[model samples]
Target: MNGDDLTKEELLSRFLQLEQRVEELEQELTQKNKRIEEQNEQIEELEARLRKYENPHTPPSKRRSATPRSPTSDSDEDDDNVRTDGGTPGRNDGHDPEWRTVSDPDEEVEVTCDCCPECGEDLDESVGVSPRLVEEIPDPQPPVVTRYNRHCYECESCGTATVASHPDCPDEGQFGVNVIAQAALSRYEQRLPYRKIADRFEQLCGLELSGASAWHATERAARAGRCEYEQIRRHIQDADVVHVDETGVKRDGDQAWIWTFRTAEHTLYAVRESRGHDVPAEVLGEDFAGTVVCDGWTAYPAFTSNLQRCWAHLLREAEDVADDHKKGERIHRSLRQMYVGLQAWLETDPTVRERAQMHRSARAELTSLVERSETDGAVATLLGKIEGGLDHWLTFVGEPAVSPTNNAAENALREPVVLRKIIGTLRNDHGMFVHETLLSLLATWRQQGRNPYEELKRVARDNEMISRAQAVPVVEPSG
Candidate 1:
């Protein structure tokens, strides 16, 4: 009945309407599909981000053993890969025992058979003597503390008073210079808290020192070496190249930073409230003339334009980036290739002047890498850092005095880092002052090849505050 009632035109219109409806539904479905694809891509991106960005300071032993070695990281070209016998584990069969070479025996103890046991015959000095070296420490003796008496006299003629005192003894103080120095050295170098330091002094030196007394002794040592600390700061300023680094420190329930500055002649440590540019400014001063080697910390760039960004830090970051995906691997490998090339360049031409020319050729590739950055990811973030600090990154290649990494500063900072871990924090500003001054002086003295123990003793007994020049070390350099 419907076919009979409807015209041919009406039938055609209904078919057209149905076709239009189908096209509209298809367009709506296509938009929704596009959005779903975009969402999936974003989810994958996030997942990759999560998989990457492992701790930079994580030891290689702690990393996931199941993760394959980065394809770009492996190289068969290393000389270590050349055909060689797999080295046997542990010590070799030819290992010689590290024996002590005795100089002269302190006392000669003779073991002699005065009479022949078998015959009961008297042997008149007939037995030859056999000597054996036995090394031993003498019984613990009372701490040898030498006291010097100082006498004051008054002259009747001019009413003048004078006192005669020993140079190695502290005036008016009961403890000898040695006691003060050793106790202070133990506190800082050994990272012992005052109570432990007091116990150590009491046990080892037979001097009953209270915790407060031990702290006072260290403060005195710090005061004596204040000149040396200042001298080290000046040395860094005048250095041809200086390495700088900062590490976290907790102080009195608050946070602080321990900034380490290393020069050819000295390593100086500073404790400050902030890990900002001001820290370096305090060390290097404004308009620092020397080359600065540092990590990619934002604070460092603010200090000096002549900066050598740490290649090791960058490489580790690259590895972190490469941990998850092909993009990161490509980035890591590309950066690694540049590092290798730069190293080869340095090896071929070790002179400082040759650095600029060596890196001139690689500029374009570096620029390309920097110009291209990821929106949000480890690889992108790392590339962003490199891009932002290209000059700093490449500076070492051109400056021979500047190393490619901040290892020198890092090594110098290790002492205080251990100290922080042990002692936790300085109680107040005075504590910070003592810690910084003594550590800087001790580190500088050690670098200068002076005996830290003896140097410390000499520092404690000085009557007049001396200039660094006046306090010049007389002791010969030692291993």
Candidate 2:
């Protein structure tokens, strides 16, 4: 065993054996490192998935289901007394019954007792009269069909042909303005499918309408409203504050986006193939000076420097992280308290100096909160978000006109989202155009408190006039 006593060959063989053992150990170490790396990746993936369930950004409809509870014991006596039929039958005790009376009557009918039921004797004595009114819809009537004969004449003075136009007729379509307007309302406001709209017209109005006709009617309405849509877009650009948001949609099985730019008076929707900064820039223009209220999506910051990041979205994310982490809980509490305090300060109708002071104080407090060190992953992520949006977190405190949330844009998109769910996808680009134009006009009319049906009819009539003007050639007479 001693080196001095061992032979050269024995020493050499021992050295080789030691080297071989070292190589085997190195290979084993490499395999173990690979396995550890694989496990780490799996752990990260699971955490990400769990976060989706825990995060407030994930809608309740999409979140994982909670654990099922044990079945309730039907043997319990208390269960028998629970009323499942919707509460008590009558209204609450303090409420009074309300009966409507009409001031004007369209028709009147008088009734008198002609015979006594007991003895079959005719009696016509008017002592007292009680008036009762019942309102009912008249039975559906067939739609009136009118045919317009547009006569073409050649002007002898200029050798040009001109066509006579009628106010009741549209230049291009067979249906009148009222019919087209109703079809558009049914499709956009009521969110009815084309086939359903056609069926409804056929059953209710005795009009044999095809799905294609319904679609064509909507297209005409959209074309008519295109000017109004552009006007809304211009108004959004000029607004003092605008709320912006986007949601995913599909067109022809390809990914698309629906962008909403909303103000207090107007709502504009754009359907585009892109969910990038270009969409906003195109709508608001690159020189837009108004403040935009939006969420923390990267596209927004890239589009505009003037922004009020949505506190609702931030608080939701913070609330999610706070559920499991202590540091995050503290951060969430601080943020919420600051938001509430800011709101309270705004309610007092502060002067400009006061607003500036409050903004500075709130910004400092936010900075202090984000400065706190957090070892938890969720907490650190939240702090990073706060730090990233540090400048925007207090923008609303300085500007009284701007809102703290993008709820307007979100609310405007809700109806369209429901339509998307029902239809699954817009069939083509024409469908997208129809939706964006008609939906924008209808929403804007509603926001402005205008009668949608009347407004739509006006737009349809205006479009008819334009078409008629375009169709009739103007001839110049030679002097």
Candidate 3:
């Protein structure tokens, strides 16, 4: 009814009813405002995630900056080779000379002075001999090509023919085993594609080889060194600890993977169709028990009896989590503390009992952190992962066998990734096998500081394994 037509009592009643309706609408608007604020918080958290870093050591400013890298830098060449070969040290005015063994001295002119400058006469007999070392590698001798001929003879009476087989020559090909193995090294370890390898071979060795021939020779070397490859597999399986990693690859335009199983002394490579648990199972075998150090991959934990989750990966994730959530910094700080605690203890080389004490402190910190009620979203997710994977991270506390990082395996896989980028993809099954075999042997030898060319020569002769100078020794703890 219209307000003008209503009486005083009726108007009062109508005003009261309208006031109540306005109050109801205000309450509903207040509830919706609360929900919208909560939603805004969530949106902010997700937006922060876009700026998180994949590597903990990387700076947030660097990641957030839109500036592109210089055109001169190549992504493939920017990474550390994951090798222990430290670069040459700078020499000052006065420093002790570092000693190194000289394999070949270009020219040893006996630098002896037969004539004394002060005496103005020959004093060969009076001068005492003093020697100083100068090391240099002369220009390499030109690579030469040689061929072997086998003589076949027939006996008149029996009408039978016999031919002599050369130990260094392949039955079906003209190239020697050494050249073939070198070609394999060029392709797998040097990160060269097949065509480039062929070009380099002709330029350096003056040997005219087609791209197909070069690839075939590489495959032949891989096949001949089967025994050496098998030995490497056994070495990895028998070790007390193995670091495992995989990189993306393609075969005939289909996605595939290249896996590396590494120890302190040996490395083994396997190319597989899938990144599932089956690939590692095929390599490490079911029921195989040892410390498997890997990143936060679920497949590793599924099969490992004793696992050491990589702290480096954890650190990376923590950096991202902290950047993206309200309680991220807190969670990341706790992780860093745990990592530093264990890292400090390991560096100290503590006794077994001391290790237990230090680990207890770290575990206590982790437990206290996980119980906090301030986390949500990404930070909360990270906490759950850390809490669930506690045992995996703690395996290295008292055990000398386990390494704290899966970087060794990643290093082993680096060259292969580069090779994949160059070649685009593998052609067929046999090509894939050859790639795996030669890469395993080449990587193993280089890791041990041995000459792969010499190793290949030894394998082609079908000789027993020859001992090479060990760069890193594999010694079992006496307990």
Candidate 4:
């Protein structure tokens, strides 16, 4: 009786285990199928994009058309000859063809020899010359040994005379500032990991360095340039208008955030624990006053300055409002009509005075729509916000000093956002600040009408700061 009971219990357990395994397999299969479907959808989308550029006569990946259309040019009579009906007639060189050659077929060839071979008559016997690919030679920057003088003197006339002591130099075995800068640039801009940078130094430069050594050097360089980083942040805050954006980043084993604040003429970045108002507050400083243009992120409004909302983001929001039927269709129709009317008004300005007049009228129309919607529904709420901000959109219509959009500032930080997506974030808050601050300086320098590479080169060559790796060294005693 005991054996029979135990056997029944074991059979029941095995059956339940089999059922669970089957369920797990089914779930995995479903996920796999879903992934396959998504991939197929992406392939179809890419194919559709490719079709836009596809001409039956062109090969894949290569552009098909030989000539590009000049929009404002008068139509040609023979597809090659310029119009001669009314305006000044263009020259019919006959050399000008309908289709342009990508590579020159009529390029002259050099004659190997001018002397005749078959008959005793001089003839032109030129052979086609093949294009020669030239290899670029990089400029040589051989390291020079630069010595610093430490003069020692003693005045022994009095008994209290003593020798002038010299401050200790950097450790003998560590890399110089130039080497450290190269390593930092390689790791930061080139996105190489510390160990990989160490490997590169050993293999390429005949220097044996450890990952820890590279990290120390980078940390030292970043710390030394903190003042310059602060200066860059100040520059961003002082700009006329600022655009703000954020992207997800990783820190150690957790998720983090990277904030980018860029103006048309400046850029500043700050890595924060949370994507909150404090990030902009810290980077922008306490007394910062400028027109901050950003998406409708709640924290963005906390800044104590006139905020100019991005029209592009507002347009997308308006789209959502239209999709939601909580408000009547009249709201959607109203928004569409207002935008269309505004676009038309924008094009009618022939002079500065006319442009100002047109802008004022358009703003008034937008304001009237807002005032009418004060007692209405969901669309009304959205329209009220847009209408209230109508003045911001019109601010640049006639003013040459302002930009019509926040695209320039957005463009400044787009690459950094992409980088954060690719490489993730710094390990800790300190590491995050160092990375963001240095990169901010690099980005702002480039935006401030200066060359980034040139600045980096100057820093690498002229800066005499010591890396953390060279803090201590073994001393050899002489007899």
Please give the range of 10 consecutive residues that has the lowest summed lDDT in model 4.
55-64
Candidate number that wins on TM-score, 1 or 4: 1
Task: Give the per-residue lDDT digits (tens) of candidate 1, residues 310-406.
Answer: 8888887778778855677877899899988887767776654565667676666788887775775766777787788777777777666678877
How does candidate 3 fare on TM-score?
0.69
lDDT of 4 by residue, 83-198 (tens): 32322244445756565435534445443766678876775755666664334445544454455564555445433333332222333325666666677677667878889988
Shift in Å, residue 385, candidate 3: 0.9
Worst ten in a row by lDDT for model 3: 463-472
Model 3: CA > 4 A from native: 1-105, 108-147, 153-162, 463-479
Clashes of each: 0, 0, 0, 0
Our model 1 lands, by Cα RMSD against the true structure, at 12.2
Whichever of 1 and 3 has more lDDT, that candidate is 1
lDDT per residue for candidate 2 within 1-479, as digits (tens), equals 57899899999999999999999999999999999999999999998988867566654344565433226735454543444333433466899987766667789989778889899988878779998877878887899988888899987777778778778877776888888888999988788889999998988899998999999998999999998899999999999899999999999889999999999999999999998999999999999999989998899999888999999888888888888786778888888988888898799999999999988888888888888888788899899999999988788888989999878888888888898998889889899999899989999999999998898889888877877767766666667
The best candidate by lDDT is 2
Badly placed stretches (over 4 Å) of model 2 are 1-54, 58-103, 117-130, 472-477
**lDDT per prediction?**
0.77, 0.87, 0.76, 0.64
Clashing pairs in 3: none
Query: What TM-score would every model get versus the actual structure?
Result: 0.74, 0.81, 0.69, 0.58
